[model samples]
Target: MPITNADVVAVFSEIADLLEIEGANPFRVRAYRNAARMLGELGRSVRTMVDRPEELDALPGIGPDLAGKIVEVVTTGSCALLQRLRKELPPVITELLKIPGLGPKRVRTLHRELGIETLAQLRQAAEQGRVQSVHGFGAKSERQILEATGRLLQQERRYKWADMEPVAQALLADLHATPGVHRAVAAGSLRRGRETVGDLDLLVTAENPGTVMDRLTASEDIQRVLEQGVTRSSVVLKSGLQVDLRAVAPASFGAAWLYFTGSKAHNIALRKLAQDKDLKLNEYGLYRGKQRIAGDTETAVYKALGLPFIEPELREDRGEIEAARSGALPRLLQLTDLRGDLHAHTKDSDGHDPIEAMAEAARAHRLHYLAITDHSKRLALVHGLDADGLSRQIDRIDEINASLRDFVLLKGVEVDILEDGSLDLPDAILGRLDLVVGAVHSGFDLSRDKQTDRLLRAMDHRCFSILAHPTGRLINERPPCDIDLPRVVRKARERGCFLELNAHPARLDLSDAACRIAKSEGVLVSINSDAHSRLQFDSLRFGVSQARRGWLETGDVLNTRTLGQLRSLLAATMARGVGQ
Candidate 1:
């Protein structure tokens, strides 16, 4: 098998753990960890260049010795030293090193004295008072261990944007309702439109900061008060969420909100531009010499810099300043620009709502049209529809359309693209649908070449109207699959297929960079929520933000067109394929 960087990093991390357990030199162990990180971030596979180990040595921290070891591992399946160490040590002992507050020495002590090999055994010893009876582990240490063990066991993992949005909205509501609070808005990663937020940050403009802070600290939802100051407070929610509230004066609210709602790189670039123009930018406000220039809104601040306002999502230091300066900033698509939602599920699949309920929700949102893109038959867990089931759904849609005076519902299928790049539903089934969203549900680990080919072939399908979340990445959890995104975008454009900027935060696949490249290549994008539930439809804001970040305009997005216009575009696409 061709070794990936992840494989190399895992092996190196294992080595580092074993070395630390052996009480090896700290720097030597640190060097290995550093090398592992360097290799993991490399754009190209290190294994492919194993013959010339010097290429590895040229990387920041990797030296001749480490490079030689990399070569050894690549040439053979294992390294002699690592294999010898593995034989001498029990794998269970190595695992203990992963627990928090228990480093190598502590792990070795637990193994030798307490005879503990795993977290469960260690927890049992702590609960039974055996851990406290040990010389180094006092009652306090025992309690700490039990707590850490519980934390490790109950770790809920990171929440996707879809998962975290409700929590954030609840917190915002609480903050807004609190006495002395004038206004409350979510800032930081949440506002910057990041797919996965490290924590929720709410900025509050309060008449009395101390009272607001006290109210927040005393809230029933707070699990622990991490920090409290007169103007700022941080707390951990009972649900393993960290929330920070910063109180600001009404006068400085805009600047504070803008500063905190930063993609740090974007702020840094803005500051540099301000400095060059003999101005100062900070959380307080924009200043020229000693006088405050703009302190109320982001637009005012940008205007002070002699530029049109930049959207928060595009504030990522990615040429926004130059684009603003040139007066050529792309007219980014907005939530109101979308005429329809193309990817939505109902009880027809695994969705919680019925078709009429989903339609009502879309109508409430004033959407011109909505597509019921339920899963195809391959996703059995989702109760994916076969041809018969789909035909029934189409009949229901037609009935609903006949009854409705407004808001059209289109017959669509989110068809699975099998590993071999073939649609789950054949052309016969696909040809009957108004829309088809081709997506990859499994075989995520295919090699780059295979994965690219799979998607490219799927795009060639006459029924493939849109490529959904092309890379299949979950932010901070799964990295993008090995597919050349630019090439995929190019293929989609050439094939007259729109690429989806999936709005469900966790899977903002075909991310901002891919969106920009796709637009440049003449590919249209659809800002889709991929909403499975009614509440999740609001995630379109994130999708709009992502599209704005890519400088996408109404012209570049399929949903930006009116219902009639979109139908014409689809008809034209079909006609083009037929003519070819």
Candidate 2:
């Protein structure tokens, strides 16, 4: 059977990680890493390139050796050298290589002297005082291992976007304040609005690159300066985030920023467009026959390619170039377009504010309405409301609405999407609410099929007005559940259920790609803050950015409507679906 592009990318990634553990040349390791990234981002399968070795070799960072390996893997399901290396190496050693500080040499020492092969064995050895007695291992190393083991056991395998947002924002702010820095902004994963960032990148424009590097290397926030030079500096922050800052002249600032802000796949597509026109694009500027043009702004760059300016979020090289060239880029939603927030908590649950205070805050924000979506009865730890509590809350909403002339407060509940695909609240309770946001708060490790079924069943509930933070991710902390998003999106559209672009900096759920896929499948999105406090309303800006990246229009979002309009839509949505 032909393997997927995902499988090919996964194999290459594992190989790259193994090579790094072996202390391979940094550039060689990077080449494989880049190849893996490119393969993962590719729309076509690696199998398609097997017949055309030249085509594969022509791709960025894929040299003869790498290209040959691609062919070998596609043809034989494995490479001789990779297979040999894996066979010769104990699986425990290979597994141990994944630990952040442990490298091949140290791994060899542990395996040979301490008989430590697996993380479990290593932990045992460290606990038994075997590892600390080794030549280089010490108390500190043992402590680090213990901490890493604790962290690994406590969380899922992948990080979420929410966990990385503050780190990226703080670092960018610090870099901007550094003396001699003319301009600075985050690029790469953070700029692309990824839910989880592998590393952070900052593009800086400065008069004296050397001075900028000096200041960056000496910054207090920097845990260690990984690499420094005139044009670029890479530092690891105290939070274990690797941030790369590159400096360029003012004249090339825009170009450099765009280049560095890239989803690399986007840049490659842009370069291809330049190639077709006999032009060259680089960090300096766009060039036609050695003549520089369009370097001052991203708009100019896109105009030079005869395309409309693509939004940063949309520049994922996923049909964006084609959409821009065809003058068909969707009129994406913006923060100012939102009329209300659909998912908010109050003192009725774990939220700090009372229902009246939450409503007043919404009025202060000039929002048309706010939904008081406190936790449901199932989440007892969070003071989740039972049916009686929800009924009382509705009466309070009526009183608040009666008291407030400027804004409306909607009765809403963040009901739990239970195991086996049932909702925490029944139709009798759900039917009384102005809005219902179905969400997964626990049992997140369900099989993909089961998770999807659970969400679909939730959407099938007539009162499920929206699906909040569909993936239930907290950036850099939790990986998303294994549910198939496309299927959920399709079901949502069919059922007139809105998918939420959760606005919490940590959640940013319905990631850019997932948002795009949802929009394409015709599911309406509710750009919700899922706010617990008034301060969190600002997180809606991040959601808007994500919506724009996904090509969501104001009309595509439920919250873009006025209070009356939104209420009408909610009623319409409820009337169509089967009751719980």
Candidate 3:
């Protein structure tokens, strides 16, 4: 199999983690980390780009040295540096970093002081109450560690949605190209747009099932073929993602798709409805007295059940069925519904692209406007803007806007919300921008009450426009900080502010449940790509899927509005006084 971007990212990320545990230079470690993130989010494949070294070197944060490493990873599937680092460290030490709240420094402390090298050892130490005795760790920290370790031990491994995309695409393409295959489609939680996917389920219609099975098992990406048959096959990929491929007759394709693309709860509810109607529903077909009534299409099945067609994303048994029955199902948000992207970054902050490049990219993606919400000075690592920097950028935006045609770039700042619920930039500076996106970059361990109050106070600010990445999570890497999100949604509704559904694959914050809450509270949600680089606009698809899962319609999203409509809404929030 060709080296995928995800493959390169995994190698780079592991190297960075091991280097951090080895107490390597912060700059050196950060280089690897940034390269990993960039490649992971890069739309183009690194393997295909290897012939053009200049393109790799031109990518932001990837110097010639890092570019060479990427080439090496793509060419050889593994780099010498990663191998050396893995050998030098206690192989499993990096596993310690997987626990929430335990960064490299803490992992090093535990390793050096207590000889803790594995989760089993760490758990034993914590259970013995010795973890708190270490420096920089208190009883509370120790307790959290214990609980996190326990959860990690018991949790089944699941891959992030983005991580599985490339592999899934490759397999689907191969299936479509197979000689006897008629159609192939991915289903299950993947089709539902879940944040994380446990396993992949693929359904195919083929003239000859044996031909498809043979092609599937012959792929280089298949690490192991657990089972292979004429009609069904299961395999584990090189990345450890399990894939199940099933061949169904064309007549039964829709039934199989519906049966496999289900939350167990959703399937149960659907079965009950079928039973109530004296009909039988299964992977074969919907039947009455052994006579097939509907099966070839999902629409026909739903219609037979006396309900409208429920979108795959809304098939999570979360009131979607009830709504479908009552003819109240929402027309879920679509990628094209967004008229603008309200959160983006540039070299002004940690983003790779320049302001002009980002604007061009958004315009190319069919957006009418793009917001340049660079980080504020509080996030020192990103070279975030101070008051003067923001002022200069504001003037720069005015100059660029004068030159542009229909598309416009909005002057904005992703200002940090301080611990005491204050804005990082002054009101005067923030008041000068098109919008202000308040974010929480620190104090993830704050009590739920304090965190909620912190966000509430920030939203109450006269200049606040939206809350960015409200939960502050990094998918499987870190848990969301404790906070009352429903309360925050209600507060936004009350204050005329909005909440962000950050579309970055790593931080799909303002989760599906939160989006539903915002919709219920009548607070518009902004589905932003939070594009740090140009290609990241592709991430908006994931955000749209997340919104669909949350039951968001075009009207429920703030960015779905036209420029004039959006300006009016934002103006109301920006000019409002406290408690208004």
Q: Each candidate: how many clashes?
A: 0, 9, 0
Query: What does the lDDT read for residue 135 in candidate 3?
Result: 91
Q: What TM-score quantifies how close candidate 1 is to the native fold?
A: 0.69
**Rank by TM-score (best first):** 3, 2, 1
lDDT tens digits, residue span 237-340, model 3: 87788899999998888888999999888999999999999999999889998999999988888899998888998988889899998889998888988999
Best by TM-score: 3
**Candidate achieving the largest lDDT:** 3
Q: Give the higher-lDDT candidate: 2 or 3.
A: 3
Say what the RMSD of model 2 is.
Answer: 17.8
For each candidate, give its TM-score against the true structure.
0.69, 0.72, 0.96
**lDDT, model 2, position 328:** 90
Minimum summed lDDT over a 10-residue window in model 1 is located at 571-580
- Give lDDT tens digits, candidate 2, residues 244-319: 8888787777777789888899999999999998899998999988888878777788889898888777788889
In candidate 3, which residue ranges exceed 4 Å CA deviation? none
Tell me the deviation in Å of residue 467 in model 1.
Answer: 1.1
Candidate 1, superposed: residue stretches over 4 Å from native: 1-159, 533-536, 578-580
Worst 10 residues of 3 by lDDT: 571-580
* Model 2, position 8: C-alpha lDDT score: 59
Error of 3 at 333 (Å): 1.4
> Relative to the unseen true structure, what is the C-alpha lDDT of residue 364 in candidate 1, on a scale of 0 to 100?
76
